[model samples]
Target: MHNQQQRIIASAAQREAAQAARLKIRAGFDRSTAGLAAGMTQVNMISVAKDWAYDFLLYAQRNPQSCPILDVLEQQHYHSILAADADIRTDFPRYRVWQHGEMVDEITDATAIYTAHPELVTFLIGCSFSFETALQDAGIPIRHIEDQHNVPMYLSNIACRPAGRISGNMVVSMRPIAAERISEAVQITAKMPSVHGAPIHIGHPESLGITAIDRPDFGDASRIAADEIPVFWACGVTPQAAIMQSKIPFAISHAPGHMLITDIPDRAWMN
Candidate 1:
């Protein structure tokens, strides 16, 4: 039962506070801590001294989807990473530490690493949440978001390219749909490639070796009614799982569902 510790936090005020902090930073301030106390749990904490943005980029290019690099945050700089106003360490609820392809420990903060070497690079990748609105817009519903829980993600038999030291089978999140609407659902979701694109497979759980729909490799499972057929989509969790397997020398990623909120609007990906 302890495969992964799931943290429950109030995300309502969290989002509102994060948005306010972003706005204040935009208006010119030393930093924005408006959402400092935001109840975010299990955000991946990682930091390393010495310039390593190039290494992160190279790793990303090799493993694009798994590590879809959204924003990279540097110690004192803000741009491709996190904004200068934010602190990389202690932002999330928990942190998983990976060194030399091995998990050393999970902690609450990595400030000590930054204290010694402030030139570390932080990267944020695209999360499956980026496409949830689209799914809702197309008349398809999301169960986890509705339940205010982490979307159920599974590590399937599918394999991703070995980008440097990262490589593993694809991970997918499942959504239940009426058996009749499966085709329409796939067509509608396929348009958004930037956000894990579309459904990788239809209703065959065995084909993907899913085993049980209710028991997932990560996150709590959602209810699937008898009238509903389980639909699966390529999940950002795929990369995280891969990185865990690879045990990169030094790596960091968002804890599942605790994504880095970005300024990129929903419509930005429409084109």
Candidate 2:
């Protein structure tokens, strides 16, 4: 907990708002947030109209591994109770705006949309970054971060159970782990269930219907070394897939990897 607290203090002292805003502005031009804001709890954000809130929450509830709920904010609220003094709209580096299930725009802020429709309900879903710190602490390397690329994510054959109108194939993020360190990665991540928990699949992506290891469906491709096995974890991006499938009238999601760095300590999510 000491280590986690130190990270929170250090990051907060740097003014997360300025960092986030700068990152967002830069991402709008280049589009990547792979290794930013290291050590803090980064959360995936999704927002829908108040009318669809119940169904969306049920969807998250049914898919805990992919859509672990960290906080639920009602219409018109931007501050997160989970992350003290945090602004959900501007704290995130980037955002994707969807209209009728189609991606309409990618922006740095969501204030305009929220202002137009104040009844939007926002959900903060746990992100895998929380566990990545733990894995790094255990001497496990994150290849994407090493190469300064977005973490590779894939759409798997695994289908999430339908919750109302929201249902789709499970999406996963992959990290190349040395054969001998697979168990160590599992043990470290398993302790943080709120942050997507442990790896769902290790080695051989084809078993999960992923045809190419280097050609990922989302994010950047990561190299798999000869001695390394690809470890897959259910990803926060899963909801975006579900949202696309559901084709709801409107929705907002944090651009992949551009997460909300919260004030909540990483240990708070540890079970």
Candidate 3:
């Protein structure tokens, strides 16, 4: 009974935090969602035309580690089942609008694009942030959250399996885990397969074709402590990388580190 009450309280708190964060975002507070809405699930979003939706879906299936899809909103739908009454077009802190694989604009609100292209299909992919609270609860430190910076992400030479017209390399987010706690960190995240589970690589960045540890292709670089080793996880940004490399005629995605804060409790995704 005691544990049940605790869960009820945590669920309510997660809902409150998720709603508040969305409200702030809708009001034009543009920033990374890292460490925001603690204990709630967060997701990355990508919207492509209806005709291109199946290809993207196949790509996600072929690359589950990098693209664990949670919810998909069909053409003309801007609402997601994961978050009640949330507007996908404006809830994310920032969005990248793409044209022929080129990023044309970065905006706080994506309503204009959705309004203009109502036929677009939106996919909500799982984010690593959803499993962060678990790591924190396990007494593991998250360097980017502690430093109040966006998590560093890199484009790797590791190629993703091709699906239809969609094909590109994988993108990965890095976290510096203490050498002693690396096992614990991996175990904590491995249970949440829906949220890019487990470290895809650890220690050597070069193995993944990352040339620099301090400079990243996306988000902010984080400091690696003397006792820590860089741990890499498959990143949802992989789809955006595909959009760029595949030269998708049109697409939109949440900016790296800028994710959709959903009402779902983080515990819901835990194994």
Candidate 4:
């Protein structure tokens, strides 16, 4: 049965996540006392559906920045992947659930949504923070990191290539890179594709068809120094744009800024 196969896939994905969690624990973030991970992957527990697991995987595949999936774990209907000890519907500070291409609710949890929709899929896309390492490595001082505000993200006029029921313009997050080190930042990021890879466009927003640099489509707008030009990148939110355009029956994503932090290290960039 397709459902049975999906269960098997979910089981496999959970085990894979458990293994990564063990490795992550060995690397640092402990799981034993996370308060809820107990008896999750290591024992008799419900395994999330593979469709959900695959959904997260596909989202990660489609959107690398905003939806970066550090790990995925599976339970009867819950998948965390690398986050075996984590809770899918509640770990993030906020969740945005969409119906018919429009936001319906901004909730702190999605347990009810899953309960009602037997086929709803969950995804954990990679965040820009993953690539922030490469930027920092290149000596590009990320201003938002110091300010503690959510990194600024904007919906651009540029369009992302379509992928399976999804397609939309790119959503770019901005970082005020100094004038002197801009090239170094680009050169360093070009090497890491798994983490959004490199800047989609830089220098001027209007050139990219973005007329209001101060008015971002999403996230807060920051001060661009007189000397610094706003640098833009293809954001993970690109896929959300796709979903919006396609107007899928239903969808869900992390609230902008409240990212699912993975234990994966930034230095592992070379990987």
Candidate number that wins on TM-score, 3 or 4: 3
TM-score of each: 0.72, 0.89, 0.96, 0.72
Candidate 2: Cα lDDT at 17: 51
lDDT of 2 at 130: 84
TM-score of candidate 3 relative to the true fold: 0.96
Residue pairs with backbone atoms closer than 3 Å in model 3 (clashes): none
List clash counts for every candidate, in order: 10, 0, 0, 23
- What would the per-residue lDDT of candidate 2 be over residues 1-271, giving only the tens digit for each residue? 3123433343455457535644554445345655565666678999999999999899888989999988889889888865666677766767899987899998887778789888799999988878877788888899988988889999999999888878898999999999999998998888888899999998878899999888998889988899998899999999899888889889999888877766665656666
Against the true structure, candidate 1 reaches a TM-score of 0.72
Give the candidate number with the greatest TM-score.
Answer: 3
Model 2, C-alpha of 105: deviation from truth (Å): 1.3
lDDT of 1 by residue, 31-68 (tens): 21212323221112234333445544675666554455
Sliding window of 10 residues with minimal summed lDDT for model 4:
38-47
Evaluated with lDDT, which candidate comes out highest?
A: 3
Candidate 4 lDDT (Cα, 0 to 1): 0.56
Worst 10 residues of 1 by lDDT: 34-43
What candidate 2 gets wrong by more than 4 Å, as runs, is: 1-31
lDDT string, candidate 3, 1-271, tens digits: 1123323224676788889999998998888999998888889999999999999999999999999988999988888878877999999999999999999999988888899998799999999998889999999989999999999999999999999999999999999999999999999999888899899999999989999989999999999999999999999999999999999999999999998898878777776
Could you arrange the candidates by lDDT from highest to lowest?
Answer: 3, 2, 1, 4
